[model samples]
Target chain A: MAKREYSYYPGCSSQKGASSSNMMKSVATMCEELDVQLNEIPDWNCCSASIGYGSGGELPRLVMSARNIALSEEHNPDQDIVATCAACWLSTREAAERFEDDENMFKEANEALAEAGMKLTNKTPIRHMAEVLIEDIGYEEIGKGVKKPLEGVKIAGYVGCQTNRPFGIDGESYENPMYLDGLVDALGGDSIPTYEKKVQCCGGALAFSEPEKSQEMIKGIIEAAYDNDADMIATPCPLCQANVEIYQDQINAKYGTKFDMPVVYYSQLISVAYGRNANDAALNGQIIKARKLEEIAAK
Target chain B: MSTNTAMVEKYRNNFLKEVEANVEEGEWVKMCMQCGVCAGSCPLGNAWEHPPQEIFMMIRAGKREDVLTSDSMWMCTSCYNCIVRCPRELPITHIMHGLAHYAKRLGIQPKGNPTQWFSEVFWNNMMKKGRVNELKLGLSMYFKDGFVSGIKESLKNAKLGMNMQKTKRMAPMEFFGGHGVKNPGDLQKIIKKAQELEAARIEEHGK
Candidate 1:
């Protein structure tokens, strides 16, 4: 098989020791096995995440992403720009889409870009890492690389907000995206097909600002997972994985329920199923350990 | 004249028209059929004093101060739930943020809104080096109230912090100076120019 290479944008949360650093690690390992080469966009800036809209405002937010795309276009021209972070993908793609639809904004964005000796031609495609995995590399190809099939593990595929609504994986319903479940099944795990809260919001950046309200929303997500009798939850977005997994203890305390559900990234699960150890799968970083996946990795 | 009052005078009591003229994606606010799907679809709908639908109605009703000064828009998580679920296909998430931004621009946003506060902090931190220093961002959040409460917040999350370090998920080195763009000065210049351009555009739109 020919190697596939794309410019990679690892958002702030995935930086070392950051909130979702483990995701970066596991995704790197998974991509290696899948023969996808990710070339990091050199000296990239923030995409001015969803939380940034209030302070960053409209044009500044667009310009911030425009700079990164400008850099990517100059450095890795013609290659599609892929972001592992849902926010990065959404923000950058939104900028490009807006620029395409609005000519004046494009001209102004380019004017700003010229301040830094750059210009946004806006030619490259901005995509999420999941889109690359599902579309670029088919499930059959992904399944072929799984050395240790997760036979008995039942996964509630959580397709949290950004990656689902507005712009989701192609052909998947907004009410219930099945790509996560499809990936799980491909890896030989039993995906709960009727997981109703699959497209629920995990509170995103508000998890910090409004903890109680965010936790209330998160509580519903975890409760739905437990109700479906899933062993673990697998998700595509880093915020979803972090928000859902890190807050379980607090939720249990607040709600007076025993909620110890393990939330792992789809990449980590893929890495583990590809015969990588816990370290390779970045499983140790999980707040609530996926003991079942750990055991599988150990084997 | 204060921008808020000036805007009120300029619009001549039509708050919805003011929003349409100023806020990002605010034009879509008038398209809301009041189906209440946005209100029902919001994850924090119950917590919202005025859900998206009510907020739209308030704008149409010309409740200027109530709509701008209210904390409702700040409660948005930008989950895009309302956007996807809206029958009118309003970019509800952007509108929520736009309302918050517009309120802040007019100097009428609710005081001490945590989301607004953090957004500012995150933007400043990112602008410094063109990439967020996560460790510093975390510390800033923990210490936002004061040193004593910061210490308390640190201790409360000590276990989580230690777990992060043990798992090699966080780097203490990031506190001194983490990774950044090679030419942050260039990025800053671009941002400054962009801000100036946006201001000029808004001024033109106001007329």
Candidate 2:
């Protein structure tokens, strides 16, 4: 079989965080075995997520993400730039859309990029890892690769707001999104239907800008997951993971619910189900401890 | 017509003007028909003196001070529900934020009791660590806001939190301490940058 190689952009969160970084490494290793090469983009910059755009305007953040996309395009003209971070994926996708739709903005942004020795073009498609894994690479292929199936372990897939919101992307929908569910099924687990708040914000910048309100919002999601009997929660965004995991205790306190639901990067869960080392997947000491997960997986 | 126009003109203020100037994209406020969809959809609307629709109406009528000083300005959850649902596509939530900033300048107190307290603790944590320490901030907020019940409940979850911390899944409280700063100088720079951004925005809007 021919190797499927993609230019990967790990973004800032993956570079600093443990679960995201570890999972990306595992995904890369898995991809290599599956004849898929994930080449990391060189000298990538920040995606300038919610904070960057919310503090300033979209132009600055868009241009920054555009510069990174432009770099990826220069390296590979045909293959999509696969982004692991949901925020990075959203920003890069929005930037590409804007570059193609808004001529004046594109021209000005490209001019700004020229000073930094970058060019902006609307050619390269931004694919979230979830999409690339499920859509381009078949689930049966992944099922064949799974050394250990996560049988009897129930996972609540939290898609986060950015990955599937504001709709209109090809093969992506706000309602009835199936990419994550398919991935979970391939790894030998049951993916439960998430609550209405599944697509809600993980209270990203709001965590700093408005703590109490953010806490309430985070509590709402965790409570919903607990109410649904999910053993663990998986998401693609590192900031979402950080916010949701860090605040799990506070949510438990506020709602008086004992939710020991471990928040893992979806890739990490995939790694675990594939019989990769659970610790290697960085599953222990998760914000919501996964001791229960370890126990369940053992049985 | 003359009487009604005069009455409308009497309520004019800078809050609406500032909102108009700060809105970068999407439908402007002129499209608001007072449908009350924003207010109705708001999770915190009942708690506010003026719901989101009322705020939009007040702003449209140029009642800037009324909108800015209204306790409802602080009641916004910033959920972006109004922004997401507005038929006019007005950035209603963001306008509320801009009004909050303006309200601070006007020396108006936030309507809800917890708004100022939460804001201070949150920003202080951010200024000190360049990130939020949820435990420290939560405790500070518990005392400052008198949410003792919340704190007592938090203690039970503290055991779970500690376990997470041990695994390094959660950030340690000490992470907020070092933050790569030897002195308060770094903190000062962050505050200065914020002040500069606010000043630049004010200048652009002539507020």
The model with the greatest DockQ is: 1
Candidate 1 lDDT, B117-175, residue by residue in tens: 89999899999999988778878888989999999999877776776677676799998
List of clashing residue pairs for candidate 2: none
Error of 1 at A198 (Å): 1.3
Across residues A50-90, which tens digit of lDDT does each residue of candidate 2 receive? 44433334454466676678778888767789988776787
Clashes of each: 2, 0
Task: Name the DockQ score for candidate 1.
Answer: 0.78
How large is the i-RMS for each model, in angstroms?
Answer: 1.2, 7.1
Which segments of candidate 1 are over 4 A away from where they belong? none
Q: List candidate 2 segments past 4 Å from native.
A: A17-26, A29-34, A168-176, A194-196, A292-299, B1-22, B26-59, B64-165, B168-207
TM-score of chain A of each: 0.98, 0.89
